[model samples]
Target: MEPLSAEEIRRSFVNSTKSQVKSMALPAKFTELPWESLDFLGWRDAKAPNRGYLVVRRDGGVTGIAVSTQASGAARRFAGLCDLCNTAHHVSDVALFAARRAGTAGREGNTVGMYICADLACSLYIRGLKELDVPQGETAAPEVRADRLTTRLESFVQRVLA
Candidate 1:
């Protein structure tokens, strides 16, 4: 993934209103982020804990969406995998989230929900930066996992826009 400027990130949003983008906060370590190491940028909104954001470069343009974090869906300490990156986490670190559809459908209350990392840091989790107890015997290499992350995330974004 390439480094994205604040302007680019703001323009990337597909599922959020312009005002949402304008008011949204960047991750706390935005300046120190290692952009070259990212498969996509994702973070829980600081000012609005229930809100989250994801951004990626797709087909020559930047694309992004707003996600709403609901409470944890799993009752056990460790349960399901994050739908995007397939990383296992303590149930408390994984939560249900939804993205409103991109247009009038969203205005009509349409949203797509799934379980994802509580911090929205699938990129770091995959690379071992934010460690989680991954299940044993998963054999895909890091590069392969990164590719899958981007592909899966794009698919989710498409669902929001579709």
Candidate 2:
């Protein structure tokens, strides 16, 4: 991943309207982000807790989407795996985030949803930069895990675009 400026990040949004991009907030420590270690950029909006954002490099360009978070209703006693990073968390730590489709379909109320880490820190989780009680015996290398995350996230983005 390459370091991006605030203007670049705002311009990269594909699934958001001008106002959405204008109003969206960057991560709390944007300038200090470890861009080289990121597979994508994702964060929850500080001003609007239900709103989340994701930006990724695709085909040499960037695409970003705004999503709304919804409760998954998973039982508290069970854990769920984030579809993006395959990291397991208590059900409450995973959420269903829905992005309105791009263009006409989105205007018509169409949306795509996926289960993801509540904090949207899949990259850190995969790199062991964050702590989670990962299940035993799942020893794939970090690069391999990152590749999988990129594939899965892009698939979700494609769904929103499609």
Candidate 3:
């Protein structure tokens, strides 16, 4: 995914008077993150432990969601993995995020957040630097790919908030 502009991100929160973009407490090493690696902006708040948030701009609007470093403690009943890249994520890598959907049919509720490898350097294992090995091929099942992407999206969301 492409990076979103600050103005685009700001416009996403126009509907929610209660929502606001707060500064993230990124590790000093990651302070100079490049813009291209991000699909949206995510950050974690020092005041709140294990709490983070993400802002994704899509279809001319943005969707902001709150994320958590901890897992939901739920198992993955899904069959597929990530669509972009074929990789299987353990259940522990997934969590849930809450946000208000954009547009006329939008609703406010919880959404799934999963952590996958994409070099956000947000995961503790990577220490905010270095990329993990995500397989490059079309051998994995589509379901597995989709499931992986879902989890990865969640992970990416968490990193943005972190």
Who wins the TM-score comparison? 2
CA RMSD of each candidate after superposition: 1.9, 1.8, 8.2
Q: What's model 3's overall lDDT?
A: 0.43
Per-structure clash totals for the candidates: 0, 0, 25
Candidate 3 to truth, TM: 0.42
- Which lDDT tens digits does candidate 2 get at residues 1-162? 998889888998877889989999899999999998899999999988899999998996889899999645655867778999999988888899999999999999999999999999999999989888646344899999999999999899999999
Q: What range of 10 consecutive residues in model 1 has the weakest lDDT sum? A: 71-80
TM-scores of the candidates are 0.91, 0.93, 0.42
For lDDT, the strongest prediction is 2
Off by over 4 Å in 2: 71-75, 134-137
**Candidate 1: misplaced stretches above 4 Å?**
71-76, 134-136
Among all windows of ten consecutive residues in candidate 3, which has the lowest summed lDDT?
Answer: 119-128
Q: Write the per-residue lDDT of candidate 1 for residues 1-162, one digit (tens) a residue.
A: 789888989988888888889999998989899887788888888899999988888896988888998655545655567888888877777878899998899999999987888888888877878766646345788788888988898789789889
* Model 3, span 7-70: residue lDDT tens: 5554544224443343434333344655554444555546654665555555645666555555
Of 1 and 3, the candidate ahead on TM-score is: 1
